[model samples]
Target: MKKSDINQYGLKPVPDPKGNSTGKAAGKAISRVVITIVSLFFATLFIIGIFMFSYIMSLRGEEIDIDLHSLNLDYTSFIYVNDESGNPVEYKSLYGGESNRIWVDYQDIPQYMKDAMVAIEDKRFWEHNGVDWWRTLGAASNLLSSGGSFGGSTITQQLIKNLTGESDVSISRKLKEIFRAENLEKKYTKEEILECYLNVVNFGSGCKGVQAAANLYFGKDIKDCSLAECAAIAGITQNPYAYSPMNFPDQNKERQQIVLSEMYNQEKITKEEYDQAMSESENMNFVFQEATETGADDTINNWYIDTMIQDVVSDLQSELGYTKEDAQNMIYYGGLKIYSAMDSSAQEMAENAVANDRNLNSDPDMQCGVYMMDYSGRVLAIVGSSDEKEGNMWFNYATDAKRQPGSSFKPIAAYAPAIDKGIINYSSIVQDEPIPNYFDDGTAGPNNYDHQFRGPVTVQYALQQSYNPPAVRVYQQLGPQNAYNFLTQKLGFTSLVGGGVDDSNLGVAIGGVHEGVTVKEMTAAFQIFGNGGQYNEPYTYYYVEDHDGNVILDNRDNISTQAIKSSTATIMQKLLTTVVTQGTGTGAGVTGWQIYGKTGTTDIDDNSYFVGGSPYAVIGVWTGYQNPSRLRNTNASKSVFQSLMGAYLNTKQLKQFTTDSSVTSAVYCTQSGNLAGPGCPTATGWYERSNMPSECTQHQNTNTTSSRSEEEEESSSSNTSSSESSSSSSSSSSSSSSSSSASSSSSSSAA
Candidate 1:
């Protein structure tokens, strides 16, 4: 058969072993089969590459146009005060804004942090360009097996997604992320890409970057992060809320351990370091940054900003017709400049006074609210609690909490109205005897703080001693509806419940309103006396300006209304001054400062108050509990008041309360509410000169003569009764005469 002839199977004959044609032909057959298979494989690969390219291109419509520069970090809006030189001297952030983030450079990042992130997130991070194909395949397998989605995002790909806002979980979105990530890797170095990723990732609880996370979790810089802290932070990238050390410490510890184990298995950390990190992770303590209800960053240890933000939002809504959300956005992102009336020096002093008080510092449940304002009604300093670290309860007790004013409410609710109506003066006598069923509910009427009452006491004596009965008598004389009107309308305390004739009873005189008063309201009410009856509305921020310097709101123009007659305020001031000098509020006295204030303790001692101030400032301090538990001592509020006011007074010059021309000083018999007579005991008092009372009838000429005759007869009879008793009886007569002489000597002592 020919060399190319068919063998038996194909009807062609086989060639000999030495023939080159046979060997060459066999080799060509094998080559043809191999080439065909190779061509088929290349065709399949080309089809897949084309499909992927098309899918990636489909996601490039509007997303590709995003500007990376727009994602840069921004600072939150703040309440700021300028110095004498017109430069920002002090400021505090209005927390819970969108930009509560801080950026850190790649060089400043710790090595352990980078290693842990790479180990847990993408094992082939260094080997791949941007997308880890192996991780993607594994993630796909995990999704299929687990019947749920899984993330395979490399650090660079995450940066692309964050920067471009392509966060949807679709195949097209993944392709877009992969495409953009490759482009990012080409445009920047690996270090730059990693740095941007770290800075833009969310660490939850309103922390938006690694630096903020470091500070919020450890209260330290990113470069100072230990291995365990780094592992914990790295674990948060997977699920920040679920793995938060503050919210879920145990789950966070578990995730942290996984990161440490991965680091050890990958040889990114030594065995000893891995073991130490694992141990520390189990006992990690997180010191979260101070944040508001909205989870925005705030100045550490400064809680006043929370209240300041609330006021800003409300003012914005009322003045500009903006919704709450719109107002917050405007304040946070509109670059508005807030000028606050807060005196930084005074605020620091007030905060320190409360924070450092041993009584306040020792008890966490005991809370204090202090509001200090200047005579112009600008809030100078306010603190909600002694410890700013107290949980997330941002209720600003100074302005938001309605606590009983106790005896502090007396001057506003009772005396001011009584004096304004010419019904009583500081020297006018009021029966101090117990009132019967004053509430009409069979409850006994008010009593003196000492639970003992003198038969008849001057108004000054009653107020100085904080005797509850006198205040209740004055309230009854003024009527409930009238006192409520004076408090709500005249003094701008609109928070008091009920109105008109159906208002609260005599208890209102001692802070027994439906809803009590806030420290801010009480302070403003007291300022009425200091400002000579002019009620200046208490406000914090003076003005706010937008980014373009257009004034959005300006409160520099003072808003003052006449809350009481100047003479009435002067009389009230005189009465309260005696309180500080020789009354229940003597603990608040400062030498040469003419300090005037009142101390108040509620019936059950649940609330205590001291509202007093110098001529330069008015301050109100309250000590109480949220649920109203009796304090260990009623004098607790007094100590806080002394500390705060003393610190404030030390910074100012001595000033005195201005006297009104309509007011005149006089001597009157406290027993009869009449002018001083020859035999009547007298007390110095303030009265409207035109409204002075009549001469004393309790010690008229005939009665005085009769009383003297009776006393003389009695003395003679006692002396004649017994010689042995005569020496003792003569001593008694001399004592009686000395007492009468002493009673006639002074005019201003308490009767």
Candidate 2:
């Protein structure tokens, strides 16, 4: 009864044609409404997605840091060298690679570089967010049947891909890139992003960026490159080899004209300027010298730069608290401003000195390092060379090398210290004979350079003559610790080699240490003597500036305290001076100036050194066989220092510059501790004065009874009191050293 009642509303359990028709119609209507709503929602979502994606795609990619310091490069290794007189010299590099290229900001880039790039790669680069929608659409439509397999990616898009390593190449990918590019545009100014792109994008031919390409295409840096040259570079972006002036001169020229025309059409350049540029382009002789593709054997090509890079990394870690990656980035991409002390002229002279030498050039087994510095202890030039490979300029002996300095180490270790202590004057007698038990051990035997000795020589003579036995004898009395301290602590040297001889003996004096010394160390030590015994830490940079020219680090006025006594330095100077006048350094003689230095030759003649300074410049030169074997018998007789000096002084480039206007010269008697010379005929001499007459030649003598002598007497009296204070200070220093050691031990224990 209940079932019938429930069904009765429909009347009976029977199929009603009207009811079935009504239900079917209702179901169909509901389905249609659902489908319509879903379709509308999806259409709305798709539109929104497209718009959002477009907005995002139009955004600029993140600002890539185009700072010069962010790239992997040698910042201070640039080509500018100057003497103390502020006279610049040209530093020439034989290896033409990106290492020599310099970066310019987008704003500073010549209109031609920008115009050419826009002309070839993306005309709308400055105008687009990150993508050119019209170009993309056109490319897609053109390649529609091929599924958007076309070429319309803008410079900005390519930059993003290069930076992010994104491989996606779909319509969707393009859309996403546009959105990202738009974001990048927002985050970075157009100038900044462009700089990043220009510095980072690959231009083929082993060139990763435009700067590298500029160097590869043109032997000069980007700043020095001309408009036609810029056009040639721009012409090659599409297909570097296809348009490379080196491989396809005509194609490259045609491409360059196209760039010039685009630049003209875009009005990036004035009509007259464009016409001139085009005219110049016709005669633009791109000297298409192929850069030595050294990446094939990274270990062999320019190993010096690699070693320098390692030091640069270490320095960045110490100075800027940067990781290895951060240092690499700083060098390759940071756009850092690096001011180096390198004198391009001196460097060129140094390089040519090695390259042009008949003996060195003929021998494929020679290695050498040359360094130059101003009187301020700042390095001005460096030449790293090792045996030539036929016509290839490949080897670098400067930074990668370490070799014994020989007698060159004596002036730094023995003479400087003795002068500082006032123990040995320039005229003090030093008998160059067989050193009797120089080590105070029966095993000790004194040896001379050629197994010969000069007898009863002055301290200056011994040093100038590079008499090894006298040096060893002098060192034996002074103690090995003195030499070690002078080298490591006073001279600021690094890397100490061990000798079996005890610190109590003369082994240190005779260059007994087996550890190799870097050219940097030799250069720095020489610079200290030149700079009045003040240790100006060798630095490549004078100042660092931000992109906006804000100084980050400026060491222009910074100078360290006196490392050795002025009197000691004076004696050492006199002796070194004689080196040029009468000894092994005769070839280094400069007629118009006073030059002082020591010549060094190790046992078996593996390494030879010349470290010297004038009021103008300090220079260090080293020569050796590639395998560290004895030099050729002919070379063995030849004075390495003399050769270096002859090359340095005779170079036309070096002759053009003057010393610092501020420098003043004078001489003092080393033995009597006075302004007059000792009784030696050669010792009595005229000291230089700022305004001495050309013929004025007399040593300023002092008398105890003279008025000036009274003043000197008073000054000496005061100095005696100062010395008493110094003695007390020495006691205090000893206590402090002991305390420091205790504290260090305590800290270690705590750790």
TM-score of each candidate structure, all chains considered together: 0.62, 0.50
Global lDDT for candidate 2?
Answer: 0.56
lDDT (10s digit) by residue, model 2, range 674-720: 34342312333222233221321243343331223322322343322
RMSD of 2: 21.5
Query: What are the C-alpha RMSDs, in order, of all predicted structures?
Result: 23.1, 21.5
Which one wins on lDDT? 1
lDDT of 1 at 338: 88
Segments in model 1 whose C-alpha atoms lie over 4 Å from true places: 1-78, 84-99, 102-298, 361-364, 388-393, 498-503, 702-751
Indicate the worst ten consecutive residues by lDDT in candidate 2. Answer: 742-751
Candidate 1 accuracy as lDDT: 0.70
Query: For residues 1-751, could you state the per-residue lDDT of candidate 1 as single tens digits?
Result: 7545446556546756689888899999999999999999999999999987786567544234444445533235556886656676547654324446666778899999888888998777787888888878887888789965557878887676555433345666666777777766666677776777787776654456778788878888889999999998989877665676755678888999999999999999998998888788767878875433224334442445555556777888888766453465555445678887777788888888888877776667888898999888788888887656532224567777887676778888889888899888877778877666443334444544445567677787777766666777887788776887788788888776443222345556666654567888898889988888899988888888876788888888978999889998888888888777666675667666877888766655667788887888889998878788767655656677778778878877776788999888887775676777766766677888898888887776644522323223223433222110000000011110111110111011010
